[model samples]
Target: MNYLHWLSPDVDLSGDKAKVPTSGASFVKYFQPSPPASDPPHRYTFLLYAQPADFKMPKLASPLAFDLVSFAKAAGIGEPKAGTFMQVQG
Candidate 1:
């Protein structure tokens, strides 16, 4: 599985700022996996939400780090499920 790191638009990817902080990690490290199969590799996902907004994820974390949706939920600043992203595969 490939590792992924995400940051809100607020965070800078310019490499001039400090490194980003992780809210979570892979499930493999946290849970047991099924035995290997004669099948293609499965895609496992790790989702990380930013900490509450009144507080920041962490300094030097992401100047712009923090998911707007998650932040809204954590802060109770907006309605739930107000927005979402969608994709269609051909």
Candidate 2:
């Protein structure tokens, strides 16, 4: 899900390597994932992209409404260079 945003490119993944930092050099906390506790186990996938030097953050009504494709295009981020996933039981 496109729900987590990381504000700094210097994001620290040392705490939880499984969770990727969503924000980049231009924005912070654009979206975040929320797996309901009542739901069954779910697999969370993350796509890592290379942000362009001219990348810019897009305006949004809410982080929940953030769209991955649109955001990537707007921010000049190309297709994911790498990816990772983890399963969570909620």
Candidate 3:
């Protein structure tokens, strides 16, 4: 989906291993897995956010959105809003 006013930074995106300080707002909570079995199937879910289209990314890149909120604010996306979600089956 295309939001008409979000800006993103020009940076190399990587895995969560590169932990940025948690904003608490932008993170995983209440994550639960399915029922038990002889060999439980593996499963995972994730939430992703991006800047709106109108905003323009800065020259310097940010590792996480916790810091990027400042950038988003400047672009006019305001407090980053959570988008739609999807579910995965194991």
Candidate 4:
């Protein structure tokens, strides 16, 4: 789901690879993945979106009961550039 949220406001995409020392970057929401114990495997999807230069990061109250679709719609980041998913067991 929405376990982790990391943002790099200004990343250096000049090179072939993205540099790590991004400007104004941080994890607004710390990583906290809690795969179910009973379920042998849990599916997780990750999406990459482009943010505007002036886009602002938001503080979340909690990961619980969070709606990612609504948030993405409000952010207006448009369609995701890339996406992938993985399965994990608790």
Q: Would you list the rank order by TM-score, best first?
A: 4, 2, 3, 1
Give the per-residue lDDT digits (tens) of candidate 1, residues 1-90: 322233332222349653443444421223323325765554433333333446433223232333545544554545432224332222
Candidate 2 CA-lDDT value: 0.60
Q: After superposition, how far is residue 81 of candidate 3 from its true place, in Å?
A: 2.5
Question: What shift in Å separates residue 73 of candidate 3 from its native position after superposition?
Answer: 1.4
Under the 3 Å rule for N, CA and C atoms, how many clashes does model 3 have?
7
Write model 4 residue lDDT over 21-77, tens digit each, in one string: 534546453454567788778667766677776666555566555667766776677
Worst 10 residues of 4 by lDDT: 1-10
Compared with the true structure, the alpha-carbon lDDT of candidate 1 equals: 0.37
Compare the candidates by lDDT and give the number of the best one. 4
The TM-score of candidate 4 is: 0.66
lDDT scores in order = 0.37, 0.60, 0.39, 0.62
Clashing pairs in 2: 3-31, 3-32, 4-31, 4-32, 5-23, 6-22, 6-23
Q: For residues 1-90, could you state the per-residue lDDT of candidate 2 as single tens digits? A: 455444334334457563445544435543344578998877667676665666566765555545878877776767877778888775
Quick one: ranking by lDDT, best first? 4, 2, 3, 1
Which sections of candidate 4 miss by over 4 Å? 1-12, 18-25
Query: Lowest summed lDDT over 10 consecutive residues: which window, candidate 2?
Result: 4-13
Model 2 RMSD, rounded to 1 decimal: 5.5
